[model samples]
Target: MSAPETATPTIPDYAGDPNAVLNDTNAVWRHGGPPNYSNTRKNWEIAASFKSFLTDWRTVDPNKYTFVMNGGEPQSAEHMLRSNFYSPLNNDFESSHKTFKRMMPTFAWEVLEVYSGPPKVAFKWRHWGVMKNDYVGYNDKKQKVRVKAHGGPIDIQGVTVATVNGALKVEKLETWFDPLSMFKQVSKDNEVFIDEDSA
Candidate 1:
């Protein structure tokens, strides 16, 4: 019998500008915030694009911008990427962003809602992507940690509180989220639970 030709599988194209998707995306506002604060679109845009702005931070005044996670002290983008995306000590800025970008080419972000306004803005945001390729990470020891591609959505959400100067610079930013939840999704067997009593 003659063999039939099989078509190659295609990767889904990532829509919109990868660096500026959050710009066209809106940050929904529901209601109350601190008094004396104006929850305007300008403020929302600032909060929404804060991460992107930080990414191209050569234009950012070092003396004016700061970032933190949860309630911890301020850190640079390098510190944040290394700590949050992959191994804190293993992957540097280039490798960490590149690794994740390749693994999750369609990563998208949006702000669910804005709770407050500038000078000190508080909002909830989402980071999501599809596993178009294998999820690979480096541990603190620089060993490779990988999970096969599942072609499923991976998501994480969190609240961000930041202070911006009159120039719209994010002076101090803090984000709180359950990182372990996000990590569990990329695990080889997500449902594999350890026996607590045995430990």
Candidate 2:
């Protein structure tokens, strides 16, 4: 008798959008490394698509997700969602809308590359955004301050790692970026003045 035929392994199609599979809770994300920036249009499209995928956070499980920056301490999904994602956009303390909306129009990302396997996906990308107004946040001294960009664009490179389970839900996500470079760009373009003492 001929040897038994084995089933062919099937690859999951990302449907021209990696975020489609990533939105599910079984997926996990981790940072691969820093990305390389380029001014090409193709790269910009990739970055924009990936950014769209990240806008939704309802599918991520807080207990299973984690984000790390520059090899520093890993932050939980809940913490990242509240502090980095949510707080920046809608701080109750701030009288006016800050960060996200202000930078939305100029915000862009260039996806340099993507690597994928079952239950795992990685994106290397460059992010760009211009400061339209003063970006209010805590300074190095933990004091409240406003950072201005003077209408200049700020660019940085980063990587995002993601993992998925059989259910195709995103379980974890980690992102990496250079804090110093981001700060330097903002400070270089506009003056940073103290707003108030950290409460």
TM-score for each prediction?
0.63, 0.56
lDDT of each: 0.57, 0.52
Model 2 alpha-carbon drift over 4 Å, by segment:
1-58, 61-63, 78-97, 140-142, 196-199
lDDT for each residue of candidate 2 in 35-103, tens digit (9 for 90 to 100): 222432332123222333333333344356555666667665222223211233344322222354454
Q: Which candidate is the best by lDDT?
A: 1
Superposed on all Cα atoms, the candidates' RMSDs to the truth, in angstroms, are: 19.5, 9.0
Q: lDDT, candidate 1, residue 118?
A: 60
Pairs that clash in candidate 1: none
TM-score of candidate 1 against the unseen true structure:
0.63
For residues 1-199, could you state the per-residue lDDT of candidate 1 as single tens digits? 9999998844211122232323324423222211122222233333333334443332234576666776777776533433222576776655666677688876666789999876688999888888788766676545566667778888989998878665445567788987676666666365322323321
Candidate 2: TM-score?
0.56
Q: What is the Å distance of residue 2 in model 1 from its true position?
A: 91
